[model samples]
Target chain A: MRSLKKKERDKLIGDFRSGSVAALARLLSLCESESRSRRDLMSSIYPVENQPFVLGITGPAGAGKSSLINRLLFVFRKRFERIAVLAFDPTSKLTGGAFLGDRVRMAEHIKDEGVYIRSMADQGRAGGVGAGIHDTIGLLSAFGFEMVIVETVGTGQSESDVRLIADLVLVVLTPGFGDEIQAMKAGILELGDLFAVNKADQPDAERTETEIKASLALGRSQTAEAPPVFATVATQGRGVVELAGCLLEKYQELGREGVIDARRSKRVEAHVEEMLKEHCAMLVASEIKAFRTKRAKAAGRINPYRLAGALISKIFKAENNAKKD
Target chain B: MGKIRVVVAKLGLDGHDRGARVISRFLRDAGMEVIYTGIRQSPEDVCRVALHEDADLIGVSILSGAHNALVPRLIAELERSALDIPVVVGGIVPDDDIDFLRSKGVRAVFTPGTPVEEIVKTVNAIVEEKRAG
Candidate 1:
C-alpha cells in the first residue's frame, strides 16, 4: 500500500510539467482519498488555475437522460477540446447495487481521447453527490479538463445536489413522464438553468413544451439568465446540438457574471473543510485504542480535548520538521 | 512529506466496495492518512473532497463496468477543480481495459488477486517519487 501510494504520488508530481488531468483521475481512483496534503501540493505545483465549468443535467427517471447525455457529449466533443462527464446511476433497491447504465449510451466516447465520462451510483447521497464526490472532482480538475458535466439520478432529491454542484443545471422531461413535470414545479422547476423536453419525437411533444414553459413561469430561480425550454429527441439526436449550445451559453454567462469562481471557491472551501472533519474524526477513532493504552499505563488524567490538541500539534510539528529537512 | 496522505473512495453505482475498504485498512496500517469515502461518490464531489483534504492519491475501486466511463470522466472532473492528484484503479478490471485505462493516464490498475504487499510497497514508492518532484 505504501509503495503504491508512493508510486502514485511520484507519477502525479513528475507529470506536473505536462499536467495531465487523466493522471489526477487515476490517482483519486487508486487512493480513494480525501486528505489535504496532495491537494495543497497540486495547488503549489500549478498556481493560477481556474476550475472547469460545471453543468448539471437532471430530471425524472426514464427521461432519456442517458441518451441526452450521449447526444450532448457528441456536441461537446465538437466544441470542446477537453470535456468530462459524471453520470449518476440509479441505486438498486435490493442491495445498493449501482449498475453503470450510462456506458451503453456513451459507448462511442468511451474510446475518445479528449472526452472522459464517469458513472456514479446514487447510493443514498443525501446532499449533492455522496461522500467522495468532492474528492473525485478535485482529482479530475487537477487533471485538466475544461468542462465538466454531471448527470444525477432522475429524481427530485438528487436534483438538488446537481443544482448545487453545477454552474448550470438542465432539467429534462418527456411527453409521458406525467407528474414528473408537476413534481418539478415544486422545487426542481426553479433550479434548472435550462428546461429540456426530451424525446420530442414522441406524441404530445408540443403539449409537453407548453406545459414546461408554464411551469417555468411558476418557478422562480436565483438565475435570471432565462433557462430556455427546448425540445429534443435524444435517441434520434435531435435538438441535442441546440441544448448543448444553450448549456455553453449558460457557462459563459456564469463566467461573465463571476458566479463560477465564487461557487468553485466556496465549494472548494467546504469540500476541504468536510474532508478535514472526516480526517480528524477518523484520526481520533484510530488513536482511541492507543490512547487508551497510553492512558492506562499512566493513569494520568487524559482529557480528550487536550489529547487531541497535542496530537494535532505533533502532526504540524512533524510536517514542519519534514519541510525543514 | 508527512507519510504520504491517500484517500480511498468508492465511486458510482458499483457497490462491491470490499476492495476499497480492505485497501483503506492496508494503507492506514502502512502509515498513511487513508480516508475512505464510504460509498457512492460523484466525480465532482470526490474531486471536491480531494481538494479539501489535499490528498495526493485518490483510489477508486469499481467492480461495475462503468470503470471506463467513470474513470475518464473523473479525470476530467479533476481538471475542472484545478487538482492534479495521481489516480490508480482497483477491482474487477478486464485485461483489455487495462491498456485503455493507462492510455487515459491512469497510474496503474491493481487487478484482482493483487497481493496486498505489492499494493503497500508500490504506494510508498509512488508517493516518495512524486513528493520529491
Candidate 2:
C-alpha cells in the first residue's frame, strides 16, 4: 500500500470524523498494513475523548461466539445509537490468507446504518485478538461508535490477550466443556467478567453451568464476587436478552466504581509497553538480517551465542551514543 | 502492504452457493482475506458489507438466474453509497448477460467452466488496478 500524503491523510481523517464509513474502513485497512501510516493515524486519533465501551467475546472453536454476538447486537443496538463489531479469524500460517466468515452470522444487521461490522484476519498473532485490534478499536471509537464489540478468533486455553484490551470479557462455552476440574484450570476461566453456556438446549448445559459455579466457589474466597454464568441458546436467541442486560449493567457498575478508568489506564500502559517491544524487536531483526547478509561470504562458521551477545552490546552502545548526542 | 479484502456474497434467494464457497476458498488460498457473507443477501446488504469491510472488490455469486435483477441493484446501491469498489459476477451467468453485467459496472464475469486460476488472476488484477488507480 502506498503511504498517504499529508493532504490525503487530512481529508481521510476529516471524512472519518464526519461519519463517512468509507473513510473509516480505509483507515482500518491502513492500520492493518503500513506501520508508518498506522502510527500517524493513531497519533491523530488517540486524543479523541470518546472511548467506546469495548466488550470482548472469546471462547474455544465452535463455542457459538459469533452467534451470541449476533444476538447481542440486537439488544446493544437498542441502547447505543452506533455500534461496531471487530470479528477476528485466524490467518493461515502457511498461505498468509484468511477466510472471515463471522459476518455470515451477523448478516441481519448488515443493512442497519447504525451498525458497522468488519472482519479481520489475526495475521499470525498467537493471541486471541489480531495485532491490529487496538488501533482498530481506537479508529472505531474516534469514528463515534458508542460500543465496540471484539470477537476473538477461536481460542484455546492460553489465548487470554482479550482480557488486556476488553473492558468487559464474556467467555462463551458450551455443554460438556468439562467438569469442575476443567473449570479449575487456570488461564481462560479466570479471565471472564461474565460467562455464557451457549447451546443450552443440549442436555448437559445445566451441568456445565453448575460445574463452573462450583469451581468459582471453590476458587474464590467469601468476599470475591463470582462472575455470573447464563445458559443461552444463541442460535434460537434464548436467554440472550438477560445476558445482554447483565453485560450492560456490569459495564455501568464497573464505570460507577471507577474500575473502567483503572482498566483503561492499565490497558494504555500495556499497549505502550507492547509497542515499545515491537519497535525494538523490529530494529533487532533488521540488525541481525544485515549481519547475516554481510557474513554470508565468510569462511568460518559463526557462533550464534557470540553473535547475539555482540549484537546486543552494539545496540546498547548505539543507544547510549544517540542519547549522549 | 495489507492483504486485499474481498466480500464474496450470494445475492437474492439463490440457495446454490457452492460456486461462491469454492471461489472464496480459492481467493483465501491465494492470500486474500475473503469475507464470505453467506447466502440470501440483498443488494443493499452486499453494499453495506462492502462499505464496512472497505473491500477492494465485491464478488457476487448468483445461481438462481437473478443476476440481471440483483446485479444492477447492487451496482445502483454501490453508486448510492458512492463506494468505488469493483464488482465481479460468477455462477450461472449466461454468456449473453456478460456484456450486460459489465455495462452495468461489473468489473468482470465468470461462468461455470472458468478456471479457478483465471478467477484468482482476474480478482487480483482488478484489486491491483483499484489500488493503483
Candidate 3:
C-alpha cells in the first residue's frame, strides 16, 4: 500500500537503465502488487518501448531443455546486446507458476548491465498465461531488453501459453522417448517452429531426428516451410550454432509469411483479457475501501467486533446481491 | 555507492537446494534483498541473470562437478561485460580448487560444513569492506 516516491521511481528507472537487477526486481514487485498506485506506476512504465525478440523453448522433461538454453545463451550473447529469459515452471498441475532462474545459471554475470531475468509465479487466475505474461513481457521490453526468451515449463506441451508469448517456438526432444509415430501423437511435436533432438551424444538422437522430419512432413501446409529438426549435445556445447541459426531463419520466415502479425494480434487479445481482470480486482478493492471509509466517518452505533465478524459475509452478500439485480 | 543488490544462483543439474535457499533467506535476513534463482541453471543464463539482477555479489553454489567449466565462464562473462561483481563460489569445492578459484578473482570460495553464521558474517564483512574502501 506504499506509494512510490519520485526519488524511488527515478532510482528504479535509472537502475533498470543501468542494468540493475535489484531495482528491476523491486519495480516488478511493486508492479505485481494489487494496489491503485502500482497500477498507476505500471501505466507510466508501460508506455516506454523496446522491441525484443520473443523466443520460446519447450520440450518434455529430461530432454536437455536447460542444457540447450545454456548453449544458446552463450552463442546469443555474442550477437545480441542484451538478453532476458523467463523460464516457466509449473507451480502446480493446474496452477503452474513461472520462476526466473537466470540468476542461478549465470551467477557470475551479476555485474553485467546488459542482461535481465525474471520469474513469474502463477497466480492461478482464469485465462491462460496467468497474471498476464504478455503484459509483463511488454514491461520488460519497455524497460530496454533487446531479446526476450520465454521458456515454457518444459514438461508437457499442453501449456500452450508460451506460444502466446513468443514469436518463435523451439520444441526440443531426445532420442527414443517414443517411436516415429510419437511425434504424430501430438503434444509439442506440431507446435515447433524448429525441432531439436538434444543429447546428441545419446544413441537415440538420430532416430528422433528422422521421426521429426517424417512427422513434420505429414503436417503438410505449403504456406510455411516444414520445421527442421537438428541434433544437439547442448551440455557439451554441440549443435547450438545450428539451432540458433535455425531460430533466426524461422523468425525471418514467419515475418515474411505474415503469421508473425497474426500471432501479435492473438497476443494482444490475451493482453486485453488480463487487463480486464486487473481492472475488476481494482474496482472491487476500491469499492471495499470506500465502504470502510464511509463507515468509519459515520461510526456512531455499530460494534466493531460484530462488523468485523460479518465482513466476509457482507462482501459475499454484496456480490450476490449485485448479481441478482 | 547505493545499496549492493545480489542474485544468488545454483547452477547445473544439482538438485541440492537447501544451502542456496538458506543463503537467499539469510541475505534477505541480513538486510539485503536477495533473488534466489532456483535449481538446474546454465552458465549463460546465470550470467544473464546476474547482469539483469544488478547484483554486487554473484554468489554461486555448485554441487555438480561441472563447477570447473561453469564458474570460470561466469566470471569471464562478467569481466567481458565490464560488470565486475566480486564472485563468491560455494558448495563442494576441494582444497585443490580453492586457490584456483581465488586466483581467478573469486572473492571467497566457501565449501560444505561452513557454518551459516560464519557465512553470513563473512559476506557482510566483504560487502562492508567493498563499500568502505
The candidate that achieves the highest lDDT relative to the unseen native structure: 2
- Work out the TM-score per prediction: 0.59, 0.94, 0.63
For DockQ, candidate 1 versus 3, the one ahead is 3
Q: lDDT by residue for model 3 over A191-262, one digit each (tens)?
A: 788888888798877777887788888857878567788888877778889889878877878899898878
lDDT of 1 by residue, B1-80 (tens): 23355768777987677778778767765656564555767776566555534567888888887889888888898887
Q: Name the TM-score of candidate 1.
A: 0.59
Q: Alpha carbon lDDT of residue B55, candidate 1?
A: 67
- Report the number of clashing residue pairs per model: 107, 0, 16
Every model's DockQ, to 2 decimals? 0.04, 0.84, 0.18
Model 3 stretches with alpha carbons more than 4 Å out: A1-3, A14-22, A92-113, A119-132, A180-182, A219-224, A281-325, B1-51, B54-133
lDDT of 3 by residue, B1-133 (tens): 3234567888888989888877766665555546677777776767666655556677898888777778888888777766757788889898988888788788888888887788777777777776554
Tens digits of per-residue lDDT for model 1, A246-281: 888877877898977777777767766876787668
Candidate 1 overall Cα lDDT vs. reference? 0.70
What's the distance in Å from true for residue B52, model 2?
0.1
Would you list the rank order by DockQ, best first?
A: 2, 3, 1
The predictions' CA RMSDs to the true structure, in order, are 11.5, 2.4, 9.2
Sorting all predicted structures by TM-score, with the top scorer first, yields: 2, 3, 1
